[model samples]
Target: MNMNMNMNRKQGQILSERFEVAFNQVHDALRDIVQINDDRFVVLVKVGAKKYQIIETYKKDLEQYARLRNAIVHEKMEIGFYIAEPNAKVVSHIEKIANVFSRPNYALSIATKNVVYFDYRDSILKVTAAIKEHGYSKFPIYKNKKCVGLLTSSSIVKWMAQNMENSSVNLSDSHVSDIMTYEKEHPIEIVAKDINIFEVENIFEKAHRKKQKIEGVIITEHGRADESPLGMITAWDLIQIDYTVD
Candidate 1:
């Protein structure tokens, strides 16, 4: 009840208009996302919140906005009167959320840039040197300019254990391919440059449900092994991202 008897109706009307537009934007985004058209706005929020981290993040605020929208649209008020006018701050907040729901943050934004990689013919000594210099334990291994597989520190350790002699492994003679033998599992997924973070989050969740672990995500121009990588993302990166807040 923002009943300001002396409040400027012109200003309140403008704010109300903005609030309604933002409200509809959120509703439409949720409806399209959840593929539900017959339900109410609150119901859309309820369903969308379950599938989308962005929706879950602002579920409470959206529910409250649904109530306010009902009052603003249905509640009778005199000309230029506002019985349920949202403040500028609330309007701005909703607008920001609407924008986020409509166009999500890109996965490439959170990926590790300047992806340090390796060729199949490269020596293991070179891999060790690069790891020491960049501290990047996981690398995208390539063959003929196309990604063949992912090479992680864990796989490297396994390779070393199997080939060790007198507690020392020979890195000087082995090629990156030697380590790739230990990395038989393709634990990484390739994503397109325009892929959204929320969808990437779902991919990880789906893998977890199947009792599979995804080592990392490689971002490329076309989400294919043949395409050059743009960046990389790991579980650690996902942990650092609070989609609810970020």
Candidate 2:
């Protein structure tokens, strides 16, 4: 038996049903991600917003949808009626938001693919050349087919500063291993490609809170340094996308 007869449903009622379903879906999804749930939709989103860029980015809209949802409840609530139907445009928008939180984008999807990295034994000049040619600031250094560390413009600068005898630094004489000494320990975090973007963003946010700078995040097959990188996420990439980060 078709429980909802199309002919008996008002256009406002149809939009209301859709809008409420999507609105509740967004609530349920955020509730799952929130650390401390107060059993309130806006509160869950607010707490989640502090950590997940997806929630933070759409914070205002979610809050407003919460208000709009209540306003649409008809005097005769149990009849699936509405005092005012959500605009078709707004209902579609909420449905998309619900889908986003439910589906969840992965780190690999937004990361910089085909990362430009180096070997620990590779020449520093080679790194500089790649930097000049590509304007990339970070590169992962590998050894024995396993990543050893990440090289950044800062580390390269520190290497040059220490290696200079007079005014000239011998890039031709130095290798990536020589520069690796200048990089701080735990320069980057390796994560799996399957990790959700929210988790990826939270990693950066947590590092920021600790006042530790992570040069970049490497997304690999199994979240291990030994695994080759599928993609990389740097702070600049987050900034470009307006994702919250240090």
Candidate 3:
């Protein structure tokens, strides 16, 4: 009996080791499948020819599931052992997020995707032209596709006038990289799709009292920032939207 007991212990150890090896292999594959695009809190996962955007924060849960999958694949573990469902709130949240990204117009908003941007390497004249055409006073500057800072029309005018006396004012040569705001993690406020707009207003009001003021509450489904902007209730945009309605 003692010998048999020792045999079971050895088997369990071997199973654990095998599970780890397989887990690593699957982990690598899954990592490749799910990419974290930090520019927006979105995950781009390629499912065949299509790429689906998921919230980057979901990686924690996905990784957990992947490990469970690995254990099940190699250790003959019961599927139930590895398939723990997330808490109700988390599950509900994920559903909302997935819904937001799935919307058709979600990609259109400049806030959602990486829109066309100008860089310092380009001539100041070229930057000016884009601003003129796009009708934006402020342009986010980039260096090697990474945001460096923001350049406003005021800054450009001031710089140009200050250096107007110098014929060698080659703005292109002076990269905008120096004044750009580098990408930093920001906490995005979120709201559920089913929640009424009035509740969102309340959430914003309460948020204003907090130290970190909420930028805009993102409406989500499946806990993902998926579908259309259910409508961002920004303090600035709200005033314009409400007051200007004819």
Better of 1 and 2 by lDDT: 1
Q: How does each model score on lDDT?
A: 0.84, 0.82, 0.44
* Candidate whose TM-score is highest: 2
Tell me the spans in candidate 2 whose CA falls farther than 4 Å from its real position. 1-9, 74-80, 208-211, 242-246
Candidate 3 lDDT over 82-138, as tens digits, reads: 223233343334334333333323311313222235766776666667777766554
Number of the candidate with higher TM-score, 1 or 2: 2
**Candidate 2 per-residue lDDT over residues 1-246, each given as its tens digit:** 244555445676888889999998998888777757398998998888877767888898889888888787634455665565687788888888888888888878889998998888888889989999998887888998899887889988988888888899877878999988898775789998789877777788889989988778999999998888899998767656653311
Query: Clash number for every model?
Result: 0, 0, 29
> What's the distance in Å from true for residue 185, model 3?
15
TM-score for all models, in order of appearance: 0.81, 0.87, 0.32
Task: Please list the residue runs of candidate 3 whose C-alpha ends up more than 4 Å from where it truly belongs after superposition.
Answer: 1-114, 166-174, 178-238, 242-246
Tell me the alpha-carbon RMSD of every candidate: 3.6, 4.5, 18.6
